[model samples]
Target: MGGLLGVLLVWRVASALFGGGEPGLPSGGGTPASPTPTDDGGNGVPASTVEVAEDFPLPAIGTRLEFKILGLGDDPKRCEAVGLLVGDDQRTAYHHLCGDAEAGTDVYFFLVRIVNHSDAAQPIALASFEMTADGGDTLPALDVETANATREHYFPERIELGPDSRIKKFVAFDGSPPFTPARLTYVDGTQALVIHLRGTWIGA
Candidate 1:
């Protein structure tokens, strides 16, 4: 989880560094977050090499996406590099998150990772789903429609990639308030799950 937390810390710092605020940012009312940015240099990787995989499938009924973590790391929060290959498909991105377990901390650990690749803010919802791990033990699927117990939307006030100096790295925040979650459709084309799972449901 250390790696994930580091990534989250990077987000918090990057967001602040790049100024992802409303006129300033959403957390202007809270205690002045005195977050510090460590590591003057990055992981020896060029910023130009940073890539955004655009073909990863959004979780929708009738859509079954297969992925495997090519690398796994832990630093308080876990870091996972997921690999994906489909019928002649080779596009992919690293799904990273930071997990923390402090009582009443109100932090999100990227329970699931997603990217914004749409021009217009598209409507996507999560369904409470059942996923099998290794064998048969089932867990909440990443994105289920009606059954989805959580939801988050990404309508960035800006989307210029690195145009906003505030977006220093691949950053994500959990449960920003006033979030309007979308609905979902079942595989059979029927409505199965419905309702808005609050930000707390997804952690944040």
Candidate 2:
């Protein structure tokens, strides 16, 4: 379902990418309905409801990226990817994980957060993140591991990057979706979180 050049594009995982009309009414009380969150496409994944102007300028801090964790426990130590759908498929595709086949490394989508430490409006082109499996020594491509620990938006899912920026690509990955990270050594300024995640084993 993905065949783009890879520039600045938006993404999502664990939820449906396409959209259509709302589902029909419950057949006399089937499984209870989940809460319709306001900050999302009304699915489990989170997306931005704010809009950016065309002439918006970049703020002091380039762009702070963040993410939401669902299937994990509260404790950070027990909050890591161990045995879940961490690969690309129909239902549970790891859509956020983007890589350059030409470069020979993969990046994983763990989380995205915005730290507005600016006084004026922080106009960011987009927000993006990356990860590596080789101790930051080399870049690696993600193939849906059993222990992935990141979450992001995608598709009709509504997690927008930018109309043309890669950090938050307005569209999905198409080979040139703006973001071409090297290695995920300094994810948002933190050390190797994926490594810590492996040791913590969230929900283990």
Candidate 3:
């Protein structure tokens, strides 16, 4: 599992660095050839479904998975100020209190939407997800308490998502300057999902 995640992380980082549509390939119009199957483990998925071209296919927006990631958006700024809703009659602009990015670094607010498609319930632990930086180091999601202090939308430390249900919330991560972020990754045992988010955010 660790080795597989490492390989996919490299591919994701390469895609970000080169701005490619599929790893090293540039974006273009062409009917790509079909993927051929091979003898390889699929992290519980059938081997036939994991083709050579897409050994680890990215989950598209709205696609169903046990715990699917529908979208993500990043708000990268230093001590960024924003308006907040107070009660039902007032809204005020104030410096957010979520958490502070390290000096010389920026804080990234990742708005992530997830869906549970299985028949049983599953736990969505914030620790399962992390932002991988160019330097190969990772930053875990911020604690729920610090994040909730901002009073902005935030995911709890852990929560259960019912089958066929969906949720959306913000997750905070401290950004590493001079070292671009390569991707946001979620891992559950041997199964893994990769979200390429180096130059831009996906979903919304």
Winning model by TM-score: 3
lDDT of 2 by residue, 1-204 (tens): 122222112222322332221223223422212222224323211343231111001111222332211121111221122222222211111123233333432223332223333343433322222232323323322322122222234212223333223332121222223233222222223211111122212122
Q: Which stretches of candidate 2 lie over 4 Å from their true place?
A: 1-109, 123-128, 138-204
The digit string of per-residue lDDT tens for model 1 on 62-154 reads 112211111112223243323233344332223333334233322222222222333433222333222222232323222211222122222
Candidate 3's C-alpha lDDT? 0.42
Alpha-carbon runs more than 4 Å astray in model 1? 1-79, 86-89, 97-125, 141-204
- Tens digits of per-residue lDDT for model 3, 4-118: 2222222211112212122221233122234344354323324444221211123322123322222211232323333222233221111222233233544445445666766
Q: How accurate locally, in lDDT, is each candidate?
A: 0.24, 0.24, 0.42
Each candidate: RMSD: 19.5, 16.7, 14.1
- What alpha-carbon RMSD in Å does predicted model 1 have with respect to the real structure? 19.5
lDDT of 1: 0.24
What TM-score does prediction 2 earn?
Answer: 0.26
TM-score result, candidate 3: 0.50
lDDT accuracy of residue 148 in candidate 3: 16
